[model samples]
Target: MWKGLIKTNRQKEFFKKAERIAEEACKHLTKTDREASFSYETLKVIKDVKYPSMSLAKSEGGEGLSLYELLLMQEKIAEGDGAAALSIGWHMGIMMELSQEQLWDKAAYDRLVKQVVTDQKVVNRAATEPATGSPTRGGVPETKAVKQGDQYRLNGRKSFTSMAEHLDFYIVSAYVEDKDTVGWFLIDRHQAGLSIDKTWDTLGMRGTASDDLVMNDVKVNEGDLVELKSEGKPNAKGWLLHIPACYLGIAVAARNDAIAFAKDFQPNSLNTPIAEVAHIQDKIGEMEWKLMQAHSFLYSTAKKWDEEPEQRGLMGSELAAVKLAVTNTANEVVDLAMRIAGGRGLSKKYPFEKYYRDVRAGLHNPPMDDAVIAMLAKQAISKD
Candidate 1:
């Protein structure tokens, strides 16, 4: 069995819970992947454990886990089921961001946090749109919110709303007509005009339920408007490290399966197991080296985010670089594992195919590789 990086009792407890959740969630992966359906059972387990609220401050009735801890948990969960990890990662990241930054309206956010902690409800931001592309690209939203007496009527569609099947509250982004700027509105799931479009068919991470959110004149309280769009570059988001952590977990899964196959399988032409073959040993060595590099890059960066508060604001490039490097390294590790396992790796009897597909999805997530590289390039070439 592959060893984990956990060192302390606190992380040990969290890793155990995450491992249990992953084991339970893995049972449904084949069915979900084949049918492109979601597993509500997996979500029930997560909510029962209150995994989403673990990042909240201790004063706010949460475990107050650090970024490194949360990322470690996220990685562990992804080892069993990437889709489940990806879906829950959004909720965990959102909760952490809210508690750490207090970027939303105080009263409204406090009420929402109460509901989240007590009711075990989950929240995720609905920001991407069909026309505007990714929100990270600085595109103005096509969704519009018009003020009407003590209410704001929102009518537009949000794409890639992950965890849509179970999201209790969607922090939706829209153009506030009165304010002439984009703002985030905390829209309730039970709102009259809100509906899910269920159009999340994809090659990988299909179980994320990243469908479209359709709002037709949905009304929200005036105070539900949580945050307005800010000018200039956004702050460094250390919580997004969960994205690379997930892919790394998938890579670890692939490596484990390949090692097992190499140890057990023996061809008639060879008296010994393939694990003893020189070329096979080479592949395993490369996989281990890459995994070590990825693990170091991800955990060290997350530890910095947790222990050094004063430097976080200036870590935007470094944080994105972690995502770019770890995710790409994960992609390589999965591919190498597939090679070691041979053609059978692609068969449904094995899981390398799934890991291969799922790891690629991280490239499409926010703070895309091209964007991160461009930011780094400009930072290097410009005058200090």
Candidate 2:
């Protein structure tokens, strides 16, 4: 489906490298999930491979990969380890956005990019708060950044901060008390009042280490602020394709495992393996169909985003549609795989149980299904 997606030799090389890293990471995925721990070893491999900086421009000391290429890399990594892919996707996507739009103060963003290039430091946005669930709903943040001479004192708690323990810098959202506007504050992890609370125990994607970030009057320089529009309308976020891609990878893994099991398992009651069974073949066929649909939608949307820059400004609905379709189909595919595997799927000895749980996390990711449907509905009504 993505024959010409990697147009250049450099892109092909990068994709091949990503696949190797993914194969290596897959070796430890079960242990990582079982322990519900962050894969520091896997992260070291990713850093060594420079996967996080792949989307940064060559001028910015990166590989200068396009959004579609980045998504392909993310899918490969998720095939190895979903939690690891999700965690790193945050860093890669943020870097892409910063490089493309130059959203923050140039000096500050330059310093951050230097760290990522030279030290492979990871960063993620800490915007979700205890008071406000999803920042996309347009709620005033309880986190406050008060101007104090040449610095600002930030005080608030952010929850569900993915890769909390590994982040070198956190892009925190807070209400500027003096300006009465919401803005993003760049806070270093080693700052005096910043701390991470160990609170990331979940049913799936446990390796993400999503914890609570507490900021108690942390002092930050004036340069650390990134101001946003008062209306809170976000720019077209093509990088969100990584979310569905990650889930799709997980579904693919699950489907492959089920097929392999069906081809080998034999019982005395049957002369042949389960693969020859009519019902088993039907279930596998359904899984393949769903996976193919998701794959086509995801890659087509990504290709469009890469080929037509002008169309991106109007692609918010299309992007959300891809997310909705891919994530929903991935979930269905995983379910079918589990059904095909039967009791063995639920057994901890097999990875299918973990895949089942991890795929469900896609439902809660950004551009949620309900929100996507509402956006599509609004667009249709307005067009009519």
Clashes of each: 0, 0
Let me know the TM-score candidate 1 reaches against the reference structure: 0.97
Q: What is the C-alpha RMSD of each candidate to the true structure, in Å?
A: 1.3, 1.7
Model 2 agreement with the true structure over 1-384: per-residue lDDT tens digits: 235556778778887877876777788787767666677778788888887777899999998777888888888788888888898898899999889988877888889999999988889999998889988787789999999999999999999899898889999999998888889988889999999888778999988889899999899998888755456566789998989989988888888889999999897899999999999999999987787778888888888998999998899999999999999998999999898889999999888999999999999998888999999999999999
Error of 2 at 253 (Å): 0.6
Q: TM-scores for all candidates?
A: 0.97, 0.96
Number of the top lDDT candidate: 1
The residue pairs in collision within model 1 are: none
Q: Write the per-residue lDDT of candidate 1 for residues 1-384, one digit (tens) a residue.
A: 235578889998998889988988899998888766668888889988888789999899789989999988999999989888988898899899999889987899899889888988899999999999999888999999999999999999999988886899999999999999999999889989999998888999987878999999899989999899878677889999999999999999999988999999999999999999999999999999999999998998888888999999999999999999999999999999999989998898989999999999999987899999999999999946
Question: Candidate 1 overall Cα lDDT vs. reference?
Answer: 0.90
Q: Runs in model 2 with CA error above 4 Å? A: 1-8, 229-233
lDDT of model 1 at residue 118? 94
